[model samples]
Target: MTLSSNVIKQCALLSSLALFSLSSAMADDHTNKPVVEQLVDTLSTIAGPHPGIRKNHAKGIVVSGEFIPSPDAATVTNAVHFESPATPVTVRFSNTTGIPDIADNNPSSFPKGIAIRFHLQEDTYTDIVSISVSRFPVATPEDFLGLLNAVATSGPDAATPKPITQFLASHPAAKTFVETPKPAPVSFATQPFYGVNAFKFTNKDGEVRYGRYQIIPVNGQEYLTDEQRAAAGKDYLFEELPRRLQQSQVEFALGLQIADKDDALNDPTVVWPETRQIIKLGTISLDTVDDNGKQFAKQTMFNPLALTDGIEASDDPILLARPSAYAISFGRRISGQ
Candidate 1:
């Protein structure tokens, strides 16, 4: 680390310690934002520059498009595949060339989703899919933010800075994933995880709480082999999924694992263990029938923070950073602001 960076870390540590000491003595206030919320707030304070340009519609929706859910992108556990003639899925495979939300339609742009938008006028939740099964394995929002920035500026010769930054922020588990981005293909995917980053859940009783979601693949284990995507090339996932789905129905089920008050800092990349078997809530049906057709090939957006409750958000660091960054670029696209 640079001398300046080391000094910055020290100052941050002291400030956090002082704040925690003061806060601990105070009465526990449910009114205060949860730890996860605070993390999100912190990420906003340290936001970056992501200027997105306009783009064509995807499938029929104005939202960003899909990134092919290939093996390297498959979730690790709690994965299930389903089939239905009524709903066919189409995914767009693109290169996340620059940061999370560069020009949405940039040929090299890799960000899969725009910021989660709430029409407020409507009540609807969309698809259940992911590139990497586990949301960010990282812990801190700052680290995730750096990763996003790195992704925004990445290219073929780009260093492993994004993933490496994330590992540093979260430590332990993230380090392993970053060091060895073990590719577990959807063809061989079993339990594909979702970042389930974070969202608010309003129970039937009208209580507001937080939680994360996961997409578990139901089909037998089918992960991508190392030979699959040695490159994060364009349409990398696109070229493979068709052959797999053509032979069999490609699907995975959505499951929910609510976060308790004490369990809010949930990051998807780490294993959540069999004991926490997510409650099966829904199924993702991927058929050859894609309504999006050419449109699907045009757009892509896959932010884990985009969620609806029964499903909700958590105080996880990366989740906190995602919405704001996602929104800024998404707004840039629709409004051209």
Candidate 2:
């Protein structure tokens, strides 16, 4: 049965209410639960459950692509994909939030997601998971949990200076993150995605450096005007993707924004100066859309920590916690939760 967007939204509201009740009953025992479980539970309570859908970024489309490394890539990292002629990639573009049927124009969906998994030889692979925002809202898993809980409790009817408002007041970085302008993109092909977390790059010669990734579209950034956004269809972004791909391949230049000597390497909430050097690493060319994109997205988990010999994750707490949190969600998705 085909469900209308309104119906889906209403259903999500009901599911969220039910999950909220369940969560409240378990609230007293929350501290004893692992951080991953708490995160998943809070997300489910906030966005509601759609069986077999992801706990976060539930709306996504998978596409096939390849990475063509630049000669400059070898100067910083000896990762297998960077040294190879070409590496096959499975890419997923998604909206923010766990609501599977959120409208393309919804404010909650502004920070779009892009996950790329590089398929190396002999069953080895690495993934780059990024978002439209250049800096993250929080720096640690515990603080992130608090932020999520605040969001869950702050509804339209909540008191003045709601939970989220109070939380934001105390957290300056999160306030900045919220105030960051996230314009609605005309199409996924036109938006740039940022890797908020830093990674350690080690060359074959053993030189080590830290940097964050910036994936910019070759077509350049384009965003909907206020009038255009208001007049656009709820599924405009999703509908535009396949049609655009059919006409021509979408490409993005991948670069690393190198950190300075005194830069904060482990804090994703910290933003480096724009004047910092960016080394072109490669190009991502997505040619075909997966017919079963939704199913593929459901089955696959694009982890940020899935690294190789030359690339290692920094000491960022949020980056370190992603794999476990994603694993819990992946298990539930595959099991038809």
Q: lDDT by residue for model 2 over 241-261, one digit each (tens)?
A: 999999999999999999999
TM-score of each predicted structure versus truth: 0.51, 0.91
By summed lDDT, the worst window of 10 consecutive residues in model 1 runs over 76-85
lDDT of 2: 0.86
* Winner by TM-score: 2
Give candidate 2 regions above 4 Å deviation. 1-30
Q: How accurate is candidate 1 locally (lDDT)?
A: 0.40
- Across 29-141, the per-residue lDDT of candidate 1 in tens digits comes to 54354333333233333233333332211212222212223331112221122111122233333223323333322333322322212211133223343433344545655
* Segments in model 1 whose C-alpha atoms lie over 4 Å from true places: 1-123, 126-137, 147-174, 184-191, 196-211, 227-236, 244-248, 258-271, 289-311, 331-337
Predicted structure 2: clash tally: 0
Alpha carbon lDDT of residue 271, candidate 1? 48
